[model samples]
Target chain A: MVSVVPSLWGYAIAGYVMTAGAIGLYVVALHARARRARDRAAAIAGRRRTSTPP
Target chain B: MVSSLERVAGRITAPRGERILGWATLVAMAASAVMSLVVSPPDAQQGNAARLLYIHVPSAWLAYLSFAVVFVASIAYLATRRTRWDRLAAASAEVGVLFTALAIALGSLWGKPVWGTWWTWDPRITTTTILLLIYVGYLAVRRLSDSPARRARWAAVVGVVGFLDVPVSYLSVTWWRGLHQGTTIRLLGESTIAPIMQVALMTGVFAFTLLFLYLVTVRLRLGRLEDRAVAEALSPRLGQSAEALLEQEASARG
Candidate 1:
């Protein structure tokens, strides 16, 4: 029985790295966009409250 | 454990446990990486190149799952005119495209090493490419319209029509001879994959699914916030609150 030696490790590593990196970047982008949107919503709400006299 | 999880879920605000899900997804993805790259053995034929399967297969699964969510959500959106459903469809479409693109890239990477080419116009590959293009067009149609209701309607229609590609892509390998292989895991019976490879691949699927859920949730919340902000901006009344503007918009549309 012949053993199958590992080959194309570079391609495997590159593929995995690209997958992980892409996912990571997307996650980060989501968080950043969420935060910015939250701030904008708060600002909108705050401006409305300030303009409306109690 | 169930009770604790429920309590945590109840405590989280709109988008519900965004932090918890995000962290869980990260942990699951890390575990999957370890299992796939370190614990799994080389393939009998493809050697180390087979490791790409762990990521590629899972991504393809997620792409399908995400589009399925889009399809269901789009139908719900069209039927109900509810913002939540529209947001769900939009977020799912975005994430679905991302995963689909990743699957194509990983498949290309695997093909380059094993098939001695970066790409081929295989039936499965061509169908999957069409799938990606369809969703991208869905996203573009979403951006083309300014009115929320109009945009949602158009995108929903696209989502429903675009979903026809999913089954086509999935069955392409078997329906026609292609460079890609047929399904290894099936619903009716046991899988044909090696035990060790099966474990890693399943882990990848689980992790990628978690990540997809987290991403879509976050994207939905962002969409909601943006919608609210835009509503406020569009309101006729000076300094109108988002809630008030939303009411005004709804009434105007009605």
Candidate 2:
């Protein structure tokens, strides 16, 4: 008679996947936010430059 | 000494330095994944389910580290009223919340198999949940005041007070009966884990720490840029161009 033990690999895999996925999403969001802020600052500066008299 | 320290900080926070840190974090994370998933052996008792320990422990540890930084930064902000201290506290708290949530989620995943339940009102779990809520409230408090100084002051106070939960959460398992296990990696005494497992766990912690540093640096840079944009937008002059304003500001600093 063979004793059967349940395979527990799925839980481990799920945990790792969730950790990586959440961190990856956060990194992407941070990059997007930084890009938006940088662009806003640059655009404001450019507008000011073009509108002002030399 | 202060000038030298500032110079060191300037180099580390520079764009090039940030890029270097990012690449290094990527490499460290890759190595950690391999160590965690491939190199480490399965537990004799818990079997493959123990693998979750790698990520779970590191996420939890990083959460603790992040909040500790917030606690110190908040105190500094209250004492000195420095904007940079407030920025550091806010950045650290945001990252701490992310790791705290991740830790709880991963803990649930691990517990489902080992403890035979997905959710429980275990002492540790309860305290940790409350810890998360406190920081969430701290983040929410940042938006309450319109004045930046007022917001920072309020947030700093919350940051300092909310950190009291961290210790309670950590000690909950020992303080009361619970389904959760006690500390595995003991600082003073011998650890219960095997040598190979310890190596894998340490690798995970190192990689996660690097990732935490990288994220906070980027967040701090974003905070600076956002503040500058707001300041520029609010203080526009009729004749002066933004470039002229920037140049004048730079010369003034010089």
Candidate 3:
């Protein structure tokens, strides 16, 4: 069997996986930080409300 | 404001002598690249193809070394729970990944002519590829999680476990049938390569390592800046001018 098609496919897929993997990882990292920031903000607000004297 | 910023650049972190050394290394690395790529003898077997060995081998060495730093730093972060260690560990990982990619690609270039194939599952090549994947996953997991400490912990575990793969990759050809050439082990006077070759190879190694260090330092600085920017952007703090703007922007979000 010719190695041509499979080799090309391997290179193609590797290229995609490399890019998608990097971008997907970066986007996920950003969203995670955003979610964390939001959660942190909410927690601080909650703490403020509870701490405020009547 | 722009003039003020230009003045601020004069007061940046690095001391004068250290800055000079850094610049010296840049000059030295260029000189060594010439020595290795131009002055060094072509291998009787691979000719100029072997010239790539200078770049490929040192890069491979530094990648392993850098990741080893990440692994240790990650473990330290996990044990101490320090965010600085987390930053350093993350920085090393990104740099290690980039260098490792370079090594693998350069190796393939050498492999095409020497081995008659670009890759083989022979122990070294396979294990090295595995090492690359492990780091890729380390970076992936890091990217997937938001908490700096959490990402550091998970990546630490992966990095430590990843260490097992490195030596195996190093010894793979020695241990089994492989596409990689075994080290040219020799005894007594035969132990040394020709002086020119040794000079070329050693200079190449040092140059590449310097280049790698420069790259990693820059990457680490960028990562720290990015981390600081993101942290400041999200918080309501206003200690700095940037933070003040960030707070105002956050209010607009409200």
Candidate 4:
């Protein structure tokens, strides 16, 4: 059997890398944004409690 | 009152089984990568460059699938006027755009080596790009309104109409003369590719589908939380308690 062109390997590798990288980054961003929103909500609730007279 | 808040909070939290789905997606994707790169043999004509099909076809499938979800969910939201359907539609659109962008980029990458050009005005490429822009507009529609019902209504319209482009994109290669190849794989008929390549391609499709499901689930949960946060932020200005604010928002959404 004839061997595949060596240069084609780079293209294949790059395609996979880009696909995986995009997905991984998106997942990380989602988690980070969720954490930030949760913290913001907590802070807002805290301020509401502290500003109110006990 | 406490129960109502708890219920809202629970709805915003990650859906059950999301964690397991996430891990399964990761494993499946890894296997798919291995199968595509290591297991599958090179084509006689395209050589190893054909391996790009594993990622390219799957990303395209996902982009198409995501938009179909958005289309169906959008119709349901318009009919029922439910926030959940709206959220699902929005979440699906977001995921669909992500995959669409990936598909375009991967196609460009493949084009550079095979077609000897980084870009082209081929019917398939043009139509797919149009599909991407339409959903990008859908996301913009979501940001255009503060009122939940108005936002859902407007976005649902875009989501439904924007879906017309999907069929156009799928058929462009057939409908018009193009540099892109026509459909090689058929659901009702046999595929023209080798068995090993077909297996690798199928694995890629399964893996990406799982990933799409997991991401949409996370996005839906996050969307609800963000909506709640915005409602809560506006509560003080409206002179309403959090519970009352949520109730009003829920009713308004209905």
Top candidate on TM-score is: 2
Clash pairs (backbone) in predicted model 2: none
Candidate 4 per-residue C-alpha lDDT over B1-254 given as tens digits, one digit per residue, 9 for 90 to 100: 63685465355344557787888998999999899989998777677778889999999999999999999889987786767778889988989999999999989988988899999999999999999999999999999987877888899999999999999999998899988999888888888888888899999999999999889878877776676667656675534544455445646766
Ranked by TM-score, the better of candidates 3 and 4 is 4
Candidate 3: stretches off by over 4 Å: A1-54, B1-22, B185-192, B237-254
Q: Model 3, residue B101: what's the lDDT?
A: 81
What TM-score does candidate 2 reach? Answer: 0.91
Q: What are the runs in model 1 whose C-alpha is more than 4 Å off?
A: A1-6, A52-54, B1-16, B237-254
Residue lDDT tens for model 3, B1-254: 63574254334323453356458666876777678656886665565666676667767887888888887777776676655556667767776787788678767766776677887677777788888898888889889766554566677888788888888887787789866777643434463366687777678678666655554544444554555556554555434443244334433433
Off by over 4 Å in 2: A1-5, B1-6, B236-254
For model 3, the TM-score of its B chain against the native B chain is 0.81
lDDT of 3: 0.64
lDDT to native, each model: 0.86, 0.86, 0.64, 0.84
Give the per-residue lDDT digits (tens) of candidate 2, residues B1-254. 64686587678779999999999999999999899889998787787889999999999999999999999999987786767777889999999999999999999998988888889999999998998999999999998976677788899999999999999999998899998999888999999889999999999999999999899989988888777676567555754443344434433433
Q: Residue B91: error of model 3 in Å? A: 1.4
> What is the DockQ of the complex in model 2?
0.74
Return the candidate ranking by DockQ, descending. Answer: 2, 1, 4, 3
Better of 1 and 4 by TM-score: 1
The model with the greatest DockQ is 2
- Superposed model 4: Cα runs more than 4 Å off: A1-6, A52-54, B1-16, B236-254
**What's the lDDT for residue B84 in model 3?**
50
